[model samples]
Target: MYPHPHALEAVAVLRVAELLREAERERRLPRTSLRRRLAYWLRAWAEKLEAPNSQLGYA
Candidate 1:
């Protein structure tokens, strides 16, 4: 069964918060290159997701 809209949004917010926590952990790592790569990939993904003009039906 499909989730309710509020449930879906809650899950999304939780996931984003978890990702932010993971990012913060990565930032604390001593491997600068790895952190940079992670940031780069996250940025690339955000850009790719944001640049899509097609309606994703989320809103």
Candidate 2:
């Protein structure tokens, strides 16, 4: 049996959040620019959410 299309979504979201947080924690992403970086993440996430996925989770 295969996993569902939405199954990996949470993982993706978590990973993105964690990576961004880690970047910020390491001071790689400036505090002043955090909002822009987060906005980019949100757009990417929205794109993934709105994409039409096949059963295999491909576009």
Highest TM-score, which number? Answer: 2
Give the alpha carbon lDDT tens digit for every residue of 1-59 in model 1: 88766556545554654575586778754557875676666555444444546143322
lDDT of 2 by residue, 1-59 (tens): 98776768745765776687678679897666766778478657745754787343534
TM-score attained by model 2: 0.50
- The deviation in Å at residue 31 for candidate 2 is 3.4
Tell me the TM-score of each prediction against the true structure. 0.42, 0.50
- Give me the runs in candidate 1 sitting further than 4 Å from their true place: 28-59
Model 1, position 10, has a per-residue lDDT of: 45
Which candidate comes out best when scored by lDDT? 2
Q: Can you give the lDDT of residue 52 in candidate 2? A: 84
